[model samples]
Target: MRFTRLAGLSGIGFVLLLLGGNLALVSAGFPTPSDAVGFDEVARLHADASDALRLTSALLPTAWLLATIFAAGVFAALWRHDRIRGDGWALVGLAGILMQCVAFAGVGAARLAVATTATHDPGTASHDLGAVAGLWGLHNALFGFNQIFLATALLGLSVSGRRAGLVGRWHAAVGLLGAALLFLAATTSPYGADGVNPLALFGLVGWLLWLVWIVGYSVVLIRGVEEEVPSALATP
Candidate 1:
């Protein structure tokens, strides 16, 4: 029970960290996916927002850690349920979350490299716009592909959770809708390699839905802790 409550708190913490990091990046002039810009422009942006970029990069690892814990908690909660048992959906969801952590690590590394290079090695960055652009492309690709993992997590968890009676219909619907949009976004990712594509709107909307679904899930976990305790004490 205590561990479940801790997991719930970790989920909330993960959401807060992600929200804060993104807001910081936006405030520091991080470009949106729809904003097409050249390598020189990319370098300039990174240089200008070096502090925010570095800070966000540093914070993301912790967020990912919390995400892993939350996923594990969810899996534990559903593992013994008859509907989830032998289905492996909980494991699938856990795998998806873990993969997202790996994919986003690459994204963060690319961003941090660009920021560091632009800030500390301006001369090199100026002479080699090609390399800088390559980094930016890598970042965009990773970001786009990362949505696939998010979709997978949503699908696996929402479906299994619903069957186990751990997720309400509305919550499951949100997850399914978010999953569809995110999967569509991933399919169109190649077109957005340059970081400018109208299809990116699917990703944007899906990401917002993902946030809402996670918050709802976190609340469920937190509330479950209260409900489980009374039943646990009465058993045997």
Candidate 2:
């Protein structure tokens, strides 16, 4: 199969892996960043769910790899259009996707550390609440900031793809809307770190939109259909 086709498949794989990881996390009763519980509670939860946490951690690397490939495929598809030649929006989108991979690596590491620390010695982990809390904070911070990269990817690709006539106007609109919400969430993330807050809602809604947009985008890529560019826009 062509690399392009493989990349399209990888996009769906990425989504599936992400969904599986979330399911594992939910099944394990993992706390969200917005959970207002004390560090001791956090440690206990981690200790109880160590296996599930580890499993989630294991899924992340493969998901990030697939996400990177999908971004490259998007860039390849968009960069060929004359409208985006000098703007390099597709390249920016690719960079956003790559940066997310790097940022999420930190998230996975923090989660794994919590799982390891909590499971090894529950008493000791309780005693070292500060360390565990720090790790959890790190995880939350990374998770919050990662939305910025997602927003960047959405903005770059949506604008360029729309200009290139590679995606429908509604698709581009969804991307733009998602970008705005995610960016808002990133900006307000600090306020939401400790517990449930209004700021978290922005991220939640944006993430849902992101899932939708990515699935739609992936289907479009798999179809490999490029609408005709207008004569005026097609001119070099």
lDDT of each: 0.82, 0.79
TM-scores, in order shown? Answer: 0.91, 0.91
Q: How does model 1 score by TM-score? A: 0.91
lDDT of 1 by residue, 34-138 (tens): 678877878888988797788788898799989988888888877867767999777878888889999999989999887766676543545667668778888
Considering every candidate listed, which one attains the maximal lDDT? 1
Q: Candidate 2, which segments miss by more than 4 Å at Cα?
A: 123-127, 193-197, 226-236
For each of the candidates, the C-alpha root-mean-square deviation to the true structure, in angstroms, is 3.9, 3.3
